[model samples]
Every structure is written in C-alpha cells, then in structure tokens.
Target: MSSLLPRLHALWTKETLALLRDRHGLAALFVMPVIFILVMTMALHDAFMPGASIDVAYAVVDLDNSPQSQALVRRLDKSGSFRRIAVGQDLDAARQGIRENQYALVLGLPAKFGERLLAPAGADGQPTEPLTLLVDPTLNPALQLAFRNQTAAALGTIRADELTRRAGKLFGLPVSPAAERDWPDEIVSIAVQNQRSIRPPSSVQQNVPAWLVFAMFFVVIPIASIFIIERQEGTLQRLRAIGLPFGHILAGKLLPFFVVNQLQAVLMVLVGMFIVPMLGGEALHMPAGRSLIHWWLVAASVSLAAVAFALLVASLTRTSQQAVVVGGVGNILMGAVGGIMVPKFMMPAAMQRLAEWSPMAWGLDGFHTVMLRQGGFDAILPDLLKLLTFAALSLTAAVWLNRSSQP
Candidate 1:
C-alpha cells in the first residue's frame, strides 16, 4: 500500500507540472468558461423572465375606426408585454412596414368591427370579417403565438365589457362605462420548493453551473495532450518498467485532473457570486448548509466523469492532434446534447430526451437539484448515480484500451 501511494504521488506531481506549463490549455480550461458565462448571462437576461417586457414592436391598422376597436388597442397597450408602434390606418402601409422591417407584426381590424363586436355568427344574416394578423417571416414562431394570444385576450375583454353595458341597461342596474375593473387573472410565476418560495431561475443561475460543467469536461484537452505525448515519448513504458500497474497510472492522472475540475468549480462559483453581479447581472445563489454539501457531491461526481471520459479519449487516440480533435469535438457534442450550451427546458421534447444520455446533463441536473430546487442529498442521488456510473464505464474502457495497445 505504501509503495502504491508513493508511485501515485509521483504520477500526480508529473501531471500537475505538465498542466501548469500549458498556458493555452489552462486558458481554455479556465478563461473560456468565464467569458461564456458573462456573455451568455447578459445576452439572455430577460429571456428567462416571465413578465419581462418583450422588445418586439407591433403596429395596428384600425379599419373600423370604432370605439370598440380603439378600446381593444388600448387594452393591448395596457398589457405592457409588447411595444406598440404608431402606423397609418392604411393596411398597405402596415404591410409595407413589415416588409421594410419597421415592425414584426401588424394587426388589422376589419371594417364594422365595433358594430359586429357583440354580434354572433348569422345573427345579422351577414358574415363578420375576422381580424387579420400579418407577421414578418423572420419573427420567432413562439413570439408570434404570444402576440396572437395577447390580442385575443384583449378582444375578449372588450366583448365582455360591451355585454355587461347592454345587460346593465336592460336590467336598470347602474354601471360606469369608463370605470374598468382590474381582473384577477394576471399570471404570476412561483417556483415550487420545500422551503419558502424562491424566484424563478435567472440567466446567470442557469449559465454559471452550465458553463462550469462544460469547462470541467474540457480537462479532456490537457489530459489527452499529456497522455499522447507520454505514449510517443515512451514515458508509459518507463513507468511500467518500475512495476507501476496500469491502474496506478490511471489513478495518478485522475486525481490531479479531478482536483483541477474542483478548482474550476470554485472559480466558476466565485465568478457567478461576485464577478457576474459587478457586470450588472444577478448574483448567483448557491445552496447553503447541507444543501451545499450536496452541491459539492454533484461537483465531485462530475469531475470523476469528466476525467474518466478524457482518459478514455486519450487512450483511444494515438497522436496529440487526434486526441485534441476527438476530445474537443466530443466535449462540444456532449455539451450541445446536454444542457450546457442550451438549457434543457428550452429544448424540444425529443432533444430533452436525448440529453438524458449525456454525462454533462446529469451533472447539470444535479446542480440544479441543489441550487434551484434546494433539494437534499436524496433529490440529487439519481443524477449523482448517473454521473458515477458513466465515470466507471469510461475508466474501465480507458484501462482496457491501454492494455490492448501494449506491445
């Protein structure tokens, strides 16, 4: 046991020195993820917010010129979800505005909209001209649907008001035409949790841990580079001559890089907690007490999986260039498939299902369990198990590949 410990210590020292000397690899491991976190958090600041005002602008062409049509427009403006731009009443002008990229949407209220506001189909023996919505082709489909929903909601409120006014007059009940009552149907977002209610996740909350997981996996870059160089230089043969088992060598590489991943975790958390807020982003909130321990457990699990995966890549590739290409592209693919580059919640259902197979996704979900859900160890157990299982499989593959490649 003592002999094994000394041999492992030597291997750890060798890896540490090699990593410190690689300036470019160090930057990729540390600097790149920080920049990604800052830029992505700022860019997506309002996107995760529920009631935040959308920057998209829309215009309306009121062909009816009726009080009801005007009221509908006012209601939409009152929603304050989307910006309203003034455009001429001409339908052609609105269409041209869309073509010229002045606005992304234009709502057209057909003639006699107010007269037919309360009229049912076939009530007047005439067909009612439906509202027409013209949208720019480049606008996001989701935003288009939101606008359509908002417009429909506003129109329904106007119709209800007209119905109440008519019914009040018939029943001799007093009602004020200009006195609008605020409805209780406003949407409020609340995150369900074990403790007190917490705010829904912000951009920084999502970006920091996500990019951090990606950064940790990037240890593959340096790990593969070092492993390939040692193979070419016959360093592995010399270590093997000293009676160091393949397991000890793998163990040596694993600890140093695992430590590297942990250091990365600390740096990323500090950046999220301190640096991000300095740049006008929300400070990242980390779990406290027992929950913090659970968070670390997740981080530890991720480190193991990342280092093992890197070792597997290093073992499989013969040259430094091949290792870099395979490891680099492989990490990117895993990140894209996982929730690292894109939030899983934002992915389509099929894509989210695919993410389940990604090690990065398991790590991310574990962190989210601790940070967002404020979950206990039990809550994060599933994700931890997945990451550990991946690490075990990868390490087994790496050891097998190295043994098979031996002359």
Candidate 2:
C-alpha cells in the first residue's frame, strides 16, 4: 500500500512537469477561454437583459391622425423599448422603407381608430380595420412578437382610458383628458430564483461558465499530446515494465489535469467578477453559503468528466498530430452543441433537445442551476449524475482501449 502511494506520487509529479513544459497546451487551457469570455460577454451584453433598448427601428404610419391615433403613437414611443423612426405617411413609402432595410417594422393605424376606440371589431355591424404591422421577413420572430405585444399593451391602456372618461361623463362626474395621461402600467421584470427576486443572468454570468466548460474539456489537447508522446517514446512501456497498472497511469493523468481544471474555474470566475466589469460588462454574481458548495460540486463533477474524456481521446489516437486534430475538433463540436458557442436558450427547439446529450451541457446546466437559479445540491443532482456517469464510462473505455492495445 505504501509503495503504491509513492508510485502514484511519482506519476503525479511527472505529469505536472510534463504539462509545465507544454507551453501551447497551457495556453489552450487558460488563455483562449478568457478571450472568448470577454469578447462574447461584451458582444451579447444586451441580448439576455430585460428592458435593454432594442436597436431595431420601427416606423409608425398614422393614417387617421386622430387624437386617439396620435395618442397611441405617443404611448408606444413612451414605452422606450423599440425605437420609433419617422417614415412618410404614404403606405407604399413605408413598404419601400422595409425593403430598403431602413426599418424592420412599420405600425399602420387604420382610419377611424378614434371613432371605433370604444367599439368592438363588429359591434356596430361593420368590421373595424385593425392596425397593420408590416415587418421585414428577415427580422427575428421574437422581436416581431415583442413589438406586437407592446402595441397591444399600449392599445389596451388607451381603451381603458377612453372607457373611464366616458363612464365619468355619464355619471355626471368631472373627468379630464389629462387624468389618465400617465398610467402606472409599466411592468417591472424580476427573475424568480430560489424563491427570491433578482435580475436575470447578465452576459458575463453566461459567458464565464459557458466558456469555462468549453475550456475544461480542452484538457484533451495536453492529455492527448502527452499520452501520444509517451507511447511513441516508449515511456509508457517503461512504466508498465516497472509493474505499474494501467489504472495507476490513468489516475496519474486524471489528478493533475483535474487540479488544473479547478485552477481554471477559479481563474475564470475571478476574470468574470473583476475583469469583465472593467471592460464595460456586467460582473458575474456567485451563490453564497451552501449554494457555493453546490457550485463546487458541479465544478468537480465537470472536471472529472473533462479529464476522463481527455483520457479517452488520448487512448483512441495514435499520434500527437492525430490527437490535436481529433481532440481540437471534438472540443469544438461539443462546444457547438453544448451551449458554449451559442446559448441553448437561443437554439431552436430541436437543437436544444440535442444539447441534452452533451456532457458539457450537463456541466453548464449544473453551474447555471447553482449560479443562476440559486439552486441547492438537490437541484443540480441530475446534471451532476450525468457528468459523473459520463466520466466513469469514459474512464472505463480509456482503460479498456489501453489494455486491448497492449501486446
């Protein structure tokens, strides 16, 4: 037992020294993720935010020019979410603006919008012309729905105001047009998490963990490089000759890289908390108390999955070049599907379902459960189970592959 410990210690020392010498591998492990986090966080700053001013411009065509029509326009502008651009009153000109890419949407108030302000669509036995929203076909469907919803909200308020004014007059009660000018109808968005209210995750919150998961899986580069080199130089054979089991060799690779992945987690978290905010991005917030422990549990599970997956890649490949190509391409593919390159929330329904199969996705989901949802260990159990199960399976495959390759 004592001899086994000493041998494992020597293997760990050898791995640490080998990794230190691989400058390119070290940079891939650390430098690449920092750049991705900073760039993507700043670029996507407003995307995940609620009530961030949208850059997509829309034009309103007031066909009626009535007080009610003009009032509706004013209400929409006051919402301050979508920018309202001025377009010529001509309907054809508005359509041309959309075609020319001048604006993405145009809201046209139909004639008699004020006269039918209190009328239902067919209450008077004549169908009322509804508001028209002409949109550029290329515009995001989400943005289209947002504008439609904002207009509906504004119209509902207008209808409520007109109803109140008419009811006051009928009851011989004094009412003024200005009385309902500013309705306290603004909706405040609060993200519900852990039975508490907080803002939704900022860009840094997303990019940090996402790119960090991507970076963790990148241990495959260094692991495969070193493994292929050992095999080529007969270092692995020498170790096997000295009575070291394949499990010990795999354990040696796992521990050092596992520690490296944790260092990566700490460094990336510090970058998100301190560095990103300095670069004009929101700082990441971490959970406190037991939630922090849950976060670490997730990080540890991810590290195990990452290192084990690396070992599997190292076992499968025969050369350093093959390792690089295979490991690099594999990490990219995993990141692409795993919500690293693009957020899962933004993915199509089919794509999101596919993400459920990615180990990186499980890790990211675990981190998000703790950090974003303020979840306890119970909340992250499913993802942790997925990652750890993946690690066990990968490590088993790696050991089997190595043993089968032996003469």
Report the number of the highest-TM-score candidate: 1
- Give residue 403's lDDT in candidate 1 (0 to 100): 85
Error of 2 at 17 (Å): 3.8
- All candidates: CA RMSD in angstroms? 2.2, 3.3
lDDT agreement of model 1 with the native: 0.91
lDDT of 1 at 215: 97
Residue-wise lDDT of candidate 1 within 1-407, one digit each (tens)? Answer: 54777788788999999999999789989999999999999999988888889999999999998778888988998999999987468999899999998899999999999899998878889998899999998999999999999999988888888888878989999988754556665788999988788888899999999999999999999999998898899988987886778888888888999899999999999999999899999999988888889999999999999999999999999898898899999999999999888899999999999999999999999999888988888899999999999999999999899888887
- The parts of candidate 2 lying over 4 Å away from their true place are 1-10, 85-103, 110-112, 116-138, 167-173, 178-186, 347-353
Error of 1 at 116 (Å): 1.4
